[model samples]
Target: MPVLAQDAPIRVGGTLPLTGPLAGVGAIHKLAAEVFVERVNARGGILGRKLEYVLLDDQSQPANARTLYERLVTADNVDLLMGPYGTSSIIAAMGVAQRYNKLLVQSSLGDPSLAPYDMQFPALPIGAEPQITDTEVLLDAYAGMATPPKTIAFVTSKFPSALTIAKGGQEVAAARGLETVLSLEYEFGTKDLGAIANRIKAADPDILWSGAVGMEAVQLLDAMARIEYKPKRHFYLFPAPGPTAAHPHAEGLTTLTWFEEHEPFLANAGAADFVAAYNERAKAVGFPYPHAEYQAAAEYAAWQILAAAAEGAGKLDDAAMAEWLRANTVQTALGPRTFEGKFNAGKASTKLKQVQNKQWVTVWPADLRPSGSQFVAP
Candidate 1:
């Protein structure tokens, strides 16, 4: 712990997808970060110094995120760095962090295998092998049902992380003795899913794993409804939580989640307060689905990890902070996280959440679910 000559506000810089396709979910991260920073400052800040976050709009562009990170490090000279949302933007930010040897704590990075930087830590808890681990977790939940899916279909976007996870899932499904009825890959930004929806309807597998992001899942479901076809079971990779829950076709829709607005998750220290604060802030901004979920939990956890590392090391040194995180577990809003595994990832704490009764709730892993909440097989 080195003493500073003078007390100054610690500036942390990062980018968010403020205006683009991913803007809907991106807004949740921004609001969560804002609430975390405000609470940190209210509690005498990190290391007894005020914390200032310099967030820039990446406009959902990976190229812009790369450039903005370079500016944050070189020109702006921010004391520390936070990672941007999404896999592509996070990868771009990781490149800049590696170049400058800055410690980056990110939340929504989809693929951990692509991250080779030792200074970067993830708060998502998808584990080192998310492609394998996440897939297994999802399948494990499905297998516990009274009627497990025997055949599966995969409709994935060409996006890097989603594609990687979907491919891994296909392999896992094969090993688990499930038949693959249909496997299709589409362009990332394809708007009209009528053709794809018709193809899926024809195949009609027992379960459909949609490697979709943002509103893609909703659009696909809408297309399916037009043809009066629906799968027995469906899961989304990273759909917009609010819109998906509100959708008329979203009942029994399952997705990956680390936290939800429920008993066990809210029981974690500071979780309830954070959720309440985030809800108030979100409502003030006229944001829909103001409840804190996995995305918001992950973002707040990133701040928790960074702050814990800084306080644990008693300094703002990037190397020290990284080492602290690597050595110990930080209890985040989601749960405890450690950066000790492959690619500096924590344990795979990914849980399966489903849209039941027009709300997202943890329905799998029986113990985590609220009383009377069980998997609703369609």
Candidate 2:
């Protein structure tokens, strides 16, 4: 009953945590979606149908997402949908889409348990397979180190997505001959990470992997700094796209990412232009994150992929659009990608990135794009 509408528009609906624990990233996700919708509609809507994205606030609660998704599909009868910001919310959204047999594209989900519904496309390059790391390209970074870290520790959040990644990392790291010195999962919104940091420092692993989101990461990072618990190397998710990278404690920190600049695959594509557009608007609005942080490129790529599918289908038929996507790869801001399972296939798949001199730079896969800095070995 509580929603926004546009007359005769091709309604694209979703749920995001506009307020709550995930509010920071949720706002960026919503902006990226709206930017894509706005751009597509400005250029004569998808398949000549104006896009009206009606996003409901899930309040960062999976249960709220369940109810909100039902409203989008059953009551509002939106034409298409996009998944919400995190794993649980996305799973909730997927359920609603599957029930209605509606076409849905998702971003920001990486739990292996939910990967079984491969029916819903994922917007990231991660898999839920047992013993499979979130992004092996990153672990390869560790293995390739001249004096590679021999021991690794995982400090993670209790969230399902982080848990899956940590589990996979533990398996993969052990297989890679790295000792698992310590593995700890902290409750979300943990106020003080003193004990966690102390434990990791005591373990004194050469490598530390953080499974915390942006806020949780800050807690752990701050505590690490307080205790001077800098591991030989540190990699984390979240806070990858925000000002946290500039934090003094984040110097030489590393994380895996989906996008950067001068990707040969997208050298002459419209990807740069799309990024520029989002960057300009975001900067104007005083948004601190770049395109990478907000996932603007990937989300816009999803829109581009969906639009191409709609044009290929030549009507508002969800099945036709889905079939087209399965059979062909489309050029998106992310690069040429096909829904070959959970993630879209692309050349610049993932990057091992590090913070050097307060800037995030790529350090591996050597060819994706030069980080213009050497890997600061720990």
Candidate 3:
């Protein structure tokens, strides 16, 4: 049996959307997190101090994030703060971290604007640089199509993250000499995609781009199929339909996402083990894991840094641990990363993913592509 540390406990607090519209993704995060904490505790804790994590469900609400953060920092008096599952929640909790001077180790917040937080470091191996670079790469690749996709459309929900993605797409489209025939933003929980579908058809865009959540995306894709409106290509943003949901509507679709399993890692590292563990853990929860490599990679990397910091401090002092983390260089599935320090401190890598025969396949960055683009029959 493992002995418990009696000196002092290192308490880490986190917020996740365990129950909400985005629960599918949130659930995956929770499972991975649970295992991470369990594994750390099993190893006799960190630095002779037990690592305790207090996880709360933010219900995917930005407002709830604010309340939960205050409760954790003020009432619970956690040693440190960790970033949340979604961008909004993390953004909401960030102010509290700043005010409290707690270090925020990031996991899923990808918005480049959030990079400015000096005390915060994303667990994600990549950042906004990829989103911007990849969007341009995607547009350029589309332009090279035998029959250039002259007209493009971009759609997203009112969420700030989705809006940021859509905005990036618009910029890329403009640079590539592609006309954005349609750009629309809808409020959350919108039940109607009929009008949106009609507009896309009217514009006759060769490519259709969307930054929608999983459920909303399912509805929109179904509507497109119902109308039998198949553009030359379809590009989707993060957390969109995966193979299971995407295949039916996205049979001939081309989308960009944050993860590509087949991509050749510059350093093989522990990717195989990570994927296997992640898949097994995900299967236990009855849902195939979310495909974003960044999420899992970040989670793994965050824990690595935390362990390093804990060992360096040899105790659980918040200020001491935070300082240790900033000074340590951590290994990630992507590669070795050193904290360049945050000032919108952006540094990262990205690979493109496309749907091929109802399967998500890596297709860009040359060296990492599985086979190549599977241009659908238009």
TM-score of predicted structure 1:
0.97
Best-to-worst lDDT order:
1, 2, 3
Tens digits of lDDT, candidate 3, 1-378: 665546567778988888876666666666666666776677777766667778899988989998999999999988777778777888888888888877777676657575566777676645555446656767655555577777788888877767777787688778778788888999865768988888787887877787776467767777776799766677766553343334476665555543444546524445555666666776665664344354555666666666666677786565787666667666656556566634323456555566666566655544566554544434
Model 2: per-residue lDDT, tens digit, 1-378?
Answer: 643443367888888888987877777777777778777778888766688888899998889999999998889888888778887888888887788887777777766457455346655545435236453666787666678788889888877778877888888888878899999998865768899999998998888888877567667788888987677778886653565676678888888766665455345246666667777777777776554542656566667766787888887778888788788877766666667643432223666777776666777767654635577765
TM-score of each: 0.97, 0.91, 0.86
Task: Give the Cα lDDT of each candidate.
Answer: 0.90, 0.72, 0.67
lDDT of 1 by residue, 1-378 (tens): 765744778999999999988899889999999999999999999888989999999998899999999999999999999999999999999999998899999998899989989999998889888888777877898887788889999999988999999999999999999999999999887889999999899989988999999888889989999999888999999998988898888899899999998989998758999999988888889876778999998899999999999999999999999988888989889888878878998778889999887799997788999988888884
Off by over 4 Å in 2: 1-7, 127-135, 265-269, 291-294, 341-348
Root-mean-square deviation (CA) per prediction:
2.4, 3.4, 3.3
* C-alpha lDDT of residue 121 in model 3: 68
Candidate 3: stretches off by over 4 Å: 1-9, 125-131, 240-247, 252-259, 263-269, 288-293, 312-328, 341-344, 371-378
Number of the top-ranking candidate, with TM-score as the measure: 1
Candidate 2, position 206, lDDT = 86
